[model samples]
Target: MKKLTCTLLAATLAGTFTASALAADYTFKFQSSDPAGDKNFQVQQAWADRVEKMSAGRIDIDLLPVGSVVKHTETLNAIKLGILDGHITATSYFSGKDPAFGLIGNTVGAWSDTTQLLQYVNYGGGYQLMTELYAPYGVKFIGGSTTGVESFVSKVPVNGVADLKGLKLRAPEGLVQQVFAAAGASPVNLPGSEVFTGLSKGVIDAADYTVFSTNQKAGMNDVATHPVQPGFHSLPLIDISMSQKKWDKLPEDLQEILTTSVRDFAYDMTTQLKIADQQAVKEAQANPNITIHNWSDEERKKFREIAREQWKVFAQKSPNAEKVYQSVTKFLEDNALL
Candidate 1:
């Protein structure tokens, strides 16, 4: 009887261990520079949801928005040091570390449309190049996202290039800042969160915040009575990335799951933002005091000329910058846009 009882006990212990092993769980977190209420933030949450369902209970994900979990500037470093699993960061912020990362940030005139940018990154080796550039720093580029283009907006009338000089403009990194500085405007560097307050208080005279939808949300029209068109400084192509260490450690199945879902999220986000941007512009036009200005062909050509010279200086400073320029140029030529 004692021997029989011991045999049954061992069997029960073995069954418990097997069940526990089968139920093992893996959880990870993802972060972005946008706030929770932003569309991009919602997309990140959607990604997490899809990933969890695909992985069943074996994998879990959490979303961190804005700089809530990590400072925007420090996000890349945090992920490199293994402080976070993944993040959606601007190519501009990382330019100081690797100018090649600025390829998407500064690729003006190369991509005329969102679809073209998407094709180049996913199919034209841009995506692979981005990953290679980030690899040495212990980060992995996980394709792209859409923040739409950065165009000019102001409280005063800006009818031409001549009007841009001497204006206090808020500019992000890459060609946009360079263009404004070259044109003699004092380009201030401020994060996205501070633009509204800066404009309201007259800290900036003109600014290029974001897509029409996001800019509307930021209330750029509230203080800036005039908004410009043709998006002189096109700042499109935001990217999503991962910590190399964390990515490699993920189960092969989990990695595959994220790889597919993130790309889908990116495409969806871009399309949605584009639609919203168009509508926002129309809505902004309804306001009585706001005036919209469209650039002439001659005016557009002048901006491009200034950009060409600026690109030369950028290329001279960073080899990565040159590589990105070449890649974008190739894409443009292949598409016959050049």
Candidate 2:
């Protein structure tokens, strides 16, 4: 664990800044998909701190939370234009670019654990395929991070696919929403900023958002009294990527510092957040206002089946999607996860 004294400026960094204007040899304005209140955002700041230490103060990452410099979905373009240097965001948000992004981004219901996804990304050709996917856009796929298995936020009990029928919920986007809609729920698209108010004001009945710890920490349980534990849906790949042009100019040692620091950050995030999740679960259990739902294996299997069917359908959307679909299924099959 890193000490809290390592500082990284996390603010609205919307313009390009050069090293000449800062103390470090390089200054990257990186944006995260998580809001400032999210624990994931705190972890991101820590990752920035790790980079600074790993680079011996030669790199400065001005980490901004979601919507700080650009809307969460716009960071890839922002990086290409040098409006921002990089992003820590979900790949599924770019599903519109290619269903490949959606297929690889969440692979909805494919992961019962995060290690399965990480194993694929780091060793199962996912890294190479993702690198190729990003090349055309002038971005370099650095590495991926996760929030562990996510928990569902709900205002009502959802025990099975049958329970999802007509339930209106705000899914993160694209792949997740498509899966839920296929499972018989009415999936609404809403940004993270609006979720709490959406639930409190009766705008939506549920959400497929972040980890149990994050939802609990955000007081989401107070309004959305029922939550699904050991989430059976999405476990997103939080992609860390930089501008290809920026990456090319880095010294080999500096490049190593950035990539290696990100790998360490991924492990750090998964470990710490899982610990926080366990603690939050206990807190939720003690709260009278909340109901934690643990779906039976049979119910979970049913949801997984629905998700698998959607995977094949998505693969047909584009050539790139087919590539992602094929590689991902092979990984799951080889790992005996399918």
Candidate 3:
């Protein structure tokens, strides 16, 4: 009886130690600027799942949707303060702090295709500059995902730049808003959650939100009759970032895994969004109440012209902005997009 008891006790001790060894060493709370049910959020969740599995459960991330842990605009500060472990957020949301962020966020009318912009960020010194911009805030830029050309959903048809005049449009707070205002439109600053209600209640006449797919998912088609095609205003870049302190605490291998996972996620998301946007455009066209209009190339050129001026104004806002602006302009020039 005594020998059997000793063996059982030894076995129990080994089992406890094994279980503890297998448990995740690090757990991060990752918050996204997308609400639950949105494709962006779904992609984020998948990224988290992939990371956990790839890490062999060494690192676990809890993905939270928009406003679940903190307000979307507050994510940067939260990460900096270590109140949040990480965030997947639109960089432009912080443009008020530094126009450099705005330059990195979209560079309105800069790239006709999302992949072009993605290349600029991944290979054109964009990631380095963005890292420098976030360094002061104690945050690290891990990676970013891009949306295809955005849609300009409107209650009234916008055949050209002239149609924007006096129209109340819900635009983000950045160069996009400034450019829209420059085009003679009244730009209202509203969160993504407020956009649908704003359009439905007539608080705003139009909104330039995410791609056609996300807009459709948000039910924009039900309220807006006209959606401008070949969207020329914005192609937002959503970044994944972590607190510098927390990042430094991670093992080197874990850090590599996290960053590589995010980059892979970005690539996957771009392809998924492109396909999804195509489907959404098709669905919107089939809706009897929805009318899709494509702005003439000349009109697109005019909008880009106005946007260029606004970019200059935004660059002049800060030294950092100038630096980011020069980098992006050089990239465009190199690619002959300038």
Computed on alpha carbons, the lDDT of every model, listed in order, comes to: 0.75, 0.88, 0.88
What does candidate 3's lDDT look like per residue over 41-128, in tens digits? 8988999999989999998999999999788889999998888999998898888788888888978888778888888888999889
Tell me which of candidates 1 and 2 scores higher on lDDT.
Answer: 2
Runs off by more than 4 Å, candidate 3? none
Q: Candidate 1 on 12-83: residue-level lDDT in tens?
A: 999998887656276666678878898768766887777777777576777788777788777888888778
For model 2, residues 1-338, the per-residue Cα lDDT tens digits are: 13433323222231234343446888889999887877788989999998988887889999998898898888888988889999999888898878899899999999989888888989999899999999988999999877788999999998888999999999866678889999999999897879999999999999987899889988999999999998889888888999999999999999988888888888988999999999999999999999999889888889999999999998999999999988998988888887
What C-alpha RMSD separates each model from the true structure? Answer: 3.8, 8.5, 1.7
Worst 10 residues of 1 by lDDT: 103-112
Q: Identify the superior model by TM-score, candidate 2 or candidate 3.
A: 3
Rank by TM-score, descending?
3, 2, 1
Which residue pairs collide in model 1, if any? none
Worst 10 residues of 3 by lDDT: 143-152
Model 2 scores a TM of 0.90
**Once superposed on the true structure, which residue ranges of model 1 sit more than 4 Å away at CA?**
1-25
Residue 202 shift from truth in candidate 2, angstroms: 2.8
